[model samples]
Target: MTRRICISGASSGIGARIAVDLAREGHHLTLLARRQNLLDEVAEQARAAGATSVTPLAVDLTVPEQVRPVLEQAGRFDVVVAAAGANAALAADAQTHLKGMAWAAWHWEANFRANVLSAVTLLEGLRELDALAEGASIVLLSSIAAYRGSGSGSYGGSKAALHPYAYDLAAALGPQGIRVNVVAPGYIAETNFFQGQMSEQRHETLVGQTLIGRAGMPDDVSETVRWLTSAGARHVTGQIIQVNGGASLGH
Candidate 1:
């Protein structure tokens, strides 16, 4: 069956991959991101990939006010993928430990908004837009940092927030057949993340730590989302599926 799907952060990386994968499944997609050019690129690719229809809305999801316009047009979707954020102010306010661990208070708040609320407001705002289909599935993008601690201020903590929220949402909405789950990925490449933060040697070291012996790709995370939202996972909800290559095991 053709399903309607909405994906935030669809301009690049894991989100874009997820949109394309679903598009290949003959789904309709509403792709959201802050960059209109990139979002349009993904939308076109999605159409070419077999999506019956693809809509791109360039919106900065961190600002709650900006979401209203996009939501108005998103309509209802069988699946909603929130993958719109990365650790804010990298290296502790974009500086480094050489600059000290000093970070402004607003920086911590921004981390919360970017990582946590980016997912929360969308799932909750669906009601206002009438944009949540019955038995709809929502996948919130978190990180392995939430579990293994990547040494951060609020990046790990904020991502951790999404895990419990998924559980609460599932319990609250399960009666209505709605499902909510989370994906916590570790060391995923092909994203703007780690740009300037991770060195080639460090990347190699991290990959070595994973039992898989390779860095994770965007497609790896996207494929997990595809399964979670598919009918095969109909009985799965409120779970955190980690795509960490076993890096967190025996920790």
Candidate 2:
């Protein structure tokens, strides 16, 4: 069944991979990101991969006015993947720690704005679309950090907040013939997520915890997201599908 889908963060990483994979599955796509060039490139790739319709939208999602219009223009999709995100690690030293208070605050607010609030806003926009079909699905891109409070302060907290929000969204929309779920991924490679801050030792330690003996790939998360949006998962709303290669012992 071919369906129209809208994806955020489609310029790179897991979102980009998902866009391509969905296109290959015969889905139509509306790709949104901050970079016009990158979004266009990804849309081109999606078209080549078999997307029935490919539209690239460039906007800074953190800005409400910018995001709102683009999302409204995107119309309705059978599935919406909210995958845009940003992260930063607060320095551990004392001076840096004090300085990081302000930094963390800004980052925390931004994370909530980008990772959590943006999804909610987009969902609102979707609801306004008369073109939305019944039984539509929404997949929120959360993180395994959402399970605990140990990682970067703001990042972990913002992600953890998403779990409850996703559940609430699912419960609210399920009765309306809409399904909402969260895909929590851990340590995916090839993403600017870490911003080159993770050390080799830290990377190895993360991989060692995974049952698969390697860090997850963008495709790993993307595939699970695809499944959750498919008809096979019609009965699977309000769930957090973790794709961490067994990291954090199923957290």
lDDT of 1 by residue, 40-134 (tens): 99999999999999999988887788888779877888999999987776624554333343554555677898888888778878867777888
Best of the candidates, TM-score = 1
Measured by TM-score, how close is model 1 to the native structure?
A: 0.93
Q: Candidate 1: minimum summed lDDT over ten consecutive residues — where?
A: 91-100
**Model 1 C-alpha lDDT versus the unseen true structure:** 0.86
RMSD of every prediction: 2.3, 2.9
> What's the alpha carbon RMSD for model 1?
2.3
lDDT of each: 0.86, 0.81
Q: Which number leads on lDDT? A: 1
Give the Å shift of residue 31 in candidate 2. 0.5
For residues 171-214, could you state the per-residue lDDT of candidate 2 as single tens digits?
A: 87777788988998988989877766779999999899899899
